[model samples]
Target: MTTPDSAAADVAAKQRIIKHMNADHHDSIRRYVEAYASKSMFHSRSAQMVDIDLNQMVFSCGGQQAVIAFDPPMKAMREARERLVQLDKDALQTLGRSDIPITKFVPAYTHPAHLWNFTQCVLAMVLLPRQANWQPGSLLYDNMLYLVPGFASFVARIGWIVFVYQPQFQINVMGKPKLALQVPVEYTIVVFADGASDSLLHGSLSFSNVPTQCDFQIALARVGRLEKGKKMKPDSASRTLMGELGLIGSQKEQKREQFDYETAEKLCVCSVGPPQESSGSKTAKCEFSLHIPSYLPATAMLPSVNISYAIFATCILPDRKVLQTSQDLRIVRETVEPIRLEPSRTVYFPDTSFAVRANFDPPTFSSKNTTISTTLQLYGLSLPITNSMRFTETRWLVPREIRWVLEETAVIVTGCPDTTGHLPMSSAQRILKRRKLATGREKLKLRYPFTRRGNTPVSMHSDGSGFSVPLTVSGPKDLSLDASTALSVAGGHILHAILDESNSDLNELQWRFAVYLECGLHIWLRIGEDVFDEASGNLVNRKMDEMAYTIVCPLTTSRTVTGQHDRGDQDEPVPMIPPSYDQVWEQPPPEYATPEGFTAAEAHTTNSLVPQDLLG
Candidate 1:
């Protein structure tokens, strides 16, 4: 298995190997290409190192390609170097060219010492469009190169030694025969490797007419700032006075200085054709491949710092005028991974006489419809009852409505702080504050009403025995489920149950239930009662009991196979079992609190004055 640290180390090792080869081993790479890759009958004019790996090196020259493999997979850069040296010696002996001198294959251009010391090598290169003012008859061709750091430079040059024109007459708009214009242009593209490092830079030039000689140079410059502590040069009298007063060591104002260095490098160039088309202007295209350096930071846009790279091209016209254009390049890093999670088990409410269990068919679901199963069993003290002179009756305990809710919370950074003393607020906070103000209206309405609201009531037999009810609830089909994120402001869901309130006028009670199922499942139940307050002439909601449960939801995964050889077998869905409770009561006695603000007589009067509006 590859740990994060090991993966990082692998990336760093590859980067070091690439930089060393591209910066200092250009000649060695060319030799390897000739010895291991080139054939005697098919000699290459120019070879550029394109890519390298543990197993092999790939090179390209013009349209031809070749690969040279290591005898044993290279574990590091040291082994790679030793293997290259051996291959070079073997290649020379095999070709019977052991006497060839290294100097005979010197590159056409080389960087001067001064140009090699200015700046770190360019990280990326891009080509921009040519100037629009060039002669219409002369055609200019542009090709973009994606350069990876630590790759050898690619060079190409083309010129015409002489021009022979054969003039042809053409009819003009005015019906007069006119001679067509003919122009000759020469262009060169040179991608140079940084002498200090394996970074690459591009240089290109085009001229209206063939010149005596063509030259291309790249000037790299770096500007830096320096801050120096203030230096004190006290006069003789002041120094003596300050020494006597013990003030000679006092601080002085600081000084600042700015300095810059610039260097220019002459790129290698090659001469290419004597006019493929002799009578008209022509366009030539060239392309180079660049691999982005693994160690380079991605392009960033920030207020405090800006780091960017650009490629500049200058065309020296036959008249000694220079035409230049620049293009910006971007560096980025991207990674991707696929993840899978195990399913969960069914969970039950905790520490209560009331029995309840909730579970989903498949604990984990993608964007698909899933069913939730719930079971309830009530006995002695948990069952509700209605009393009358003719008969006393007990009823089943079940929720009137249920809802699956999705909520989100986020950590947001405000763009800027307020100039005044007020604290900054995020957009989500502002919206929440507004909603809080309307809580009275929103909370009073029924949020999720039962689909079959007016259905006939099912009676429970009272033979001194407990009963159980099993129900299946399907989640809404419109919800979008995401398993890729943690449960936070942008990623969480909950289930809520609104149990039916006791309708008996004598008992003014309500219960609210909620379940949380993320890392684990937990249940919260709040028991509250409505009481009329005669002293205040209003109704009050008093909380009586709070219960909590830690439960589990069984996890499952969907199985769908798609292949000619698949057996197509699938697992059957698990059936939900009802929870079993040991006891039930018509009206469970409330846990008592001291009646501090009202007397017992007043409480009786308040209960008697309960309005019809408060009954439901």
Candidate 2:
């Protein structure tokens, strides 16, 4: 219905408008993505479910967001804009606006609708703090580059019109077309805390992407020393001390050899004497080193040294009126390297040369009342100057087992109180006591044990040092009773407890009482029901009897990172709703706002001046 001249003008107008819209899309996208980069954000790692053509560019789009992971030419935004620009041309001609360019009209109304969808997809990919993405200019774009594809160069030449007058639109551009996002997902990484599982393990390449071999040499041993003195003749028939030493603990005792003669000669010459009268007393020293293996396969099972250590406990409660208990414990050193240990996870330690015998007796509980018996043991031991070994073993390989020969020797037990003429307690005992009456606070008095080595003394205090019973419940609510057995050594302690009448209690009445010692380390025990019977102890084995409870108590009151690292970062904030379809349709589209020094009509009139007028 329009004239040929009008139709031609309308086509030109439509083309102009489409060009402007594309220009706006590009410029805005740059601003958006850059805002995300400035904040250094990260998006969730979840993959999206895309239904686009496999042959065409496709991207994931689900969960809180979706993103097109590709370079500039491959950007989904570019492809979408191309399709939308074509639609803009068709719409403008249909409107019969022959004189106005599609570029000018599209900016005034059509473009924002298409942009809203694109902006929505991109915003979802941004990793920012909750509620941070809404600010304007947080992101920017530059659509002028659309001309680089040659045939489309005319499109960009038109966009340059705005840049010529509006310099504010041209500043602070980013290099590399990266989809920088300010998503909050980076916070989740902290959940893997210190001594936690799957920590960052450093991996390096040795030119050829093959695994490098790591060799380990483990050696563990006990050394022995001897002192020589003239033998005090034995009343019964037995080999002389000199004869036994010549062969080194063998059945066929060899005669004293050249070394023995040399030792004897030296002793004889150094014999003590008084005023020329011979006293005939001298001494010679002998020492030897022995190697023993104490480590098993436990250490190799660990993923790395940065992991925290873990302990596995099993408590045995007597069910048959007759009280009995069997306890087997193994102690190994950890932290020469950091290692990860899951709380309550069972892991074995390797390269440990420490061993101890499980010494326990079945506690005799009075039948009249539910009686409790607790046994505490310290698993690290060093030989007295002359203490003998009854058995020994080297179990460092698969199905490791102990191998040994028990040897007895004569050496004085030093550092033991001469008054008692007995060895001191091997280590420290932080709380060694029992109670019967009930109170609001589990007010059991604590006793500490200590040991002496040479002149220096070693007391068993919690690593950070001191007791940490915060609020003691006189008795666990619902459960009739509770008890604990703990020892502190090498800055750590084994804490064990038993509960009674646990089933009838509500799990919600739980409370956490923590002990903070002077050393700044805090040990917390959760007094609650054992939802999982995995807790090893006496109460768990007897289900029908008076129900029982188990609480985690620290042997040495110290703070652990495990207690501090809870699931705080897992929560994510809901993002703002994208500009809606109805809103985008109803909203005013972008227009060239007049710059400070120029009026629109004045600007058009100014361009009307001839080139020659500028020369005057």
Candidate 3:
């Protein structure tokens, strides 16, 4: 019953589907394998669709095969594509890769073991020992004379030789040894209440070797404008003592400035020691609470200046030897207060001009969209007397385009030279110098434009004296504006409108606009002026009319569930309608009747007449 033409058509359709899937939807296949196949203990590095039908899909990963079934069979290609997208999203959510984009999931090529490294294999075979007595067919020879051990030994020797002479490799393998005291967790200190409130520093310290006496102190240092190849000097008293003890030798005098070091707070006294222990190594728990000075600046690292704080713990041994350990802390300023602004201004252009006014409802916005309403009033329009005159009149001073933009600016350090010149002919020095330099001490600006929808055209009055146009604008859904900061950088939203007067036989006009800021702050803008250079394409002239507002949207505290749901048995029956109340309460209540008695009192005492054995 099978026809040759029908079979060939079916084969052609299948081949087309397979080719499309392999070319375009490779990422989806890889995601599917990572989500499902990985859970089944089949760790497939890559997957390709070998065969696909309306009801099922078969994938091959390095000759290993897997099949996935579609619950509702796809009837069209569009439906299949939609279903594939939905499945990919579900798999990403289940695998806790929701933040990762789909295009990043490329299939990894898995090479066969024999084809992994041909040169290494050849070298391994060359280094392998030859045995003439071993026969190829014997089980003993095949099991005992294997070349795996010899190849492994040769590779290990080569690796050791390559890494032994490299100092950077040795340092990476064996890091700088720490002191006897070890702190497992780093501490983050927050400066709040305008640096008036106190922050607590707490951690546990374990000692591998115990010392007789230990002194712990918390030091705060403010270092500024540190030049290259210059060392910071200690206090005058310490320098005098060192000089008196002949510790300072005759050396070249270098221009150096003393760093500001202060004992902000003392954690423990000199009498403090490690915790008492019976036999095992001892661990000490330390805690310090101190109020940070309001005059001190928050922690910041720049090219020329740095402000930092640390906790130092020093141990004095019996032989007058000292061991020390320290941990750095990070400090940040608190959130800013909310702000709101509302301004009204008017400007005059020429004989035919317009007055534009903008208003923001509520004035303050967060991550969500905010609505902006603008009104334009046109006046001094030359009226037409007759139909011929009206036909001769041309359109002039029309509002051409309106746009809303959100801009963000931040000041960061840039263009700093490398400070690793002290390393002498080390590989790390070369690597550090060869690394690309970061953009430092520069301003970061991000601009996002709002999309505009279609609106009605401008209409004129019956008298032709004046006309008004009212429009509404909103911020984009994907716009992320930062809160306003007075110290570092500022950000705000701006609304710009361009009017076309090309058809009119009038000279170009310039109008000044007012920008209102909080706390007696204001900015002025000049219209019909170019803010940037035409030939250089650089912002030579600054636009003072731009305004920045604070957006205070906090992140959601809810946690997303990334686990997969269990698909219940498909063969089980599912009712179209739920059971009714009457069906659920099918059992009726029993009717109660009083026992027949000669008198009411006897009826009440009927239970007493029963025998004791019957009651029991």
Whole-model lDDT values for every prediction: 0.31, 0.22, 0.36
TM-score attained by model 3 = 0.27
Global local distance difference test of model 3: 0.36
Which runs in model 3 stand beyond 4 Å of their true positions? 1-196, 226-272, 278-284, 302-306, 336-616
Write candidate 3's Cα lDDT for 379-471 as tens digits.
Answer: 443323334323323322223233233222222122211232121112111101111111111121211110112333444545564444554
**RMSD of each candidate relative to the true structure:** 26.1, 43.9, 38.0
lDDT for 316 (candidate 1)? 45
Task: Give per-residue CA lDDT, model 2, range 185-280, as digits (tens).
Answer: 111111112221222211111111111121111111111111123336443235455445562333322222211111110100011111222111
Q: Rank the candidates by TM-score, best first.
A: 3, 1, 2
Model 3, position 389, has a per-residue lDDT of: 29
Better of 1 and 3 by TM-score: 3
Q: Which regions in candidate 1 have their CA more than 4 angstroms from the true location?
A: 1-18, 24-83, 89-351, 359-368, 371-550, 557-616
Off by over 4 Å in 2: 1-27, 35-202, 205-616
What is the overall TM-score of model 2 with all chains considered together? 0.12
Model 1 global lDDT (CA atoms, 0 to 1): 0.31
Displacement of the residue 80 alpha carbon in candidate 3, Å: 96
Q: Could you give me the TM-score of model 1 versus the true structure?
A: 0.24
Residue 347's lDDT within candidate 3 is: 26
Model 1 lDDT per residue over 1-616, tens place: 8789877776676667656765776555566766677632222334556666778877654333467888788875457667766877887676666545655643323556434442222111111111221222223222222232112112111111111121111111113211111111211121222111223333333323222243332222111111122346678788668867877543221110111111111112232222333222333322222222223322322221122333333334334355333334443322221112222222222232343333233322346643444332323322333352112222322222222222221111212122321223331121110000000001111111111234322223254333333434344332212231111121221111111111111112122111112221222222222232324323333223322221223222222232311221122222222132211211222333323453333221000111123333
| Candidate with best lDDT | 3
